[model samples]
Target: MIIFIDSYTEEKLANSLAGRPGYFKLFYDTENCGCNGVLAIEILDQPLDTDIRISVKNFTFLVDKQQESLFDDALKLEADRSYPSFKVSSDSALYSTNVRIKDARDMASK
Candidate 1:
């Protein structure tokens, strides 16, 4: 699989990885929010016991085995510095989602 991570995202990921070790794992899955089925993205430290792992651009990503069909050969992930959010695009569609950046103090309490 081919995935693109913009420079800003790469920098942020590098910093996060350095400090938190394995704090986040990119994940893609299909979910039904209301009526329509949508792709879901999650950043979690550990993968579900049954999740499948894939590597792209030296980054580890996880996806449920059931969601493998939704995985496209080409995936684009870009970080928009203007909004400080990330956008994901695949063969099917393009969408933007916010990245939840938790403060260190907040995370420490969790």
Candidate 2:
């Protein structure tokens, strides 16, 4: 699959991961929503063996092996500077919008 990310989104993402030793994953979270799934940006200490890595201009994102088939061949990640959020979309429909990054490392420490 191909993913497009805007410059603002790219800068914001880079800032989030700066000085943090870990992996950035575009996770399709299926937990607790019945059959519907939601996408999340998760910061992980390391990627799972089942994760598939996709590299963009200067960033690498990980997706679960099972969820790889769910993505469209072309996807776009854009930033809404007004709301200061991230959105993921394809040609026909939106996959994820107003996405917030979840730092798993910080959460686990709590």
Candidate 3:
């Protein structure tokens, strides 16, 4: 898949991940949303065995192999600072406009 993240999204990521070393994984979070899942970005120290890596620009993202089919062949991820949210869309559909970016290390420590 192809992902194009805008400058605004880059700025937000830089601010949040400055000095942090990790891989960004676009995860299909199915924890509490029932069958219809949501997309999320989790910062990880390493890629998982089942991850499908997608490289775009200077960023590398991973998607769970099991959930790869959930996304389209092409996608664009942009940050909307006004709403303080992430937007993901494809040529034909808008997957989400409220994706979350979380620090995996922080969550694991808790």
TM-score versus the correct structure, for each prediction: 0.63, 0.85, 0.87
Ranking of candidates on TM-score, top first: 3, 2, 1
Mind giving the per-residue lDDT tens digits that candidate 3 earns over 1-110?
Answer: 88888787878776657677667888778897887767788877778899988886666788988888888988888888787668889999988889878878566567
Error of 3 at 77 (Å): 0.3
What count of clashes does model 1 give? 0
Across 11-82, the per-residue lDDT of candidate 2 in tens digits comes to: 888877776766778867779968667788888888889998788778778888888888887889987788
Q: How well does model 2 score by local distance difference test?
A: 0.80
lDDT of 1 by residue, 3-96 (tens): 7787777786555555554433344422445543444444556677867776656567666766656657677776667774567778676644
Model 1 stretches with alpha carbons more than 4 Å out: 16-18, 23-32, 37-40, 95-110
Best of the two (2, 3) by TM-score: 3
Model 2 clash pairs are none
| Error at 59, model 2, angstroms | 1.3
Error of 1 at 53 (Å): 1.6
Q: Give lDDT per model, in order.
A: 0.58, 0.80, 0.81
- Look at candidate 1 and give me any clashing residue pairs: none
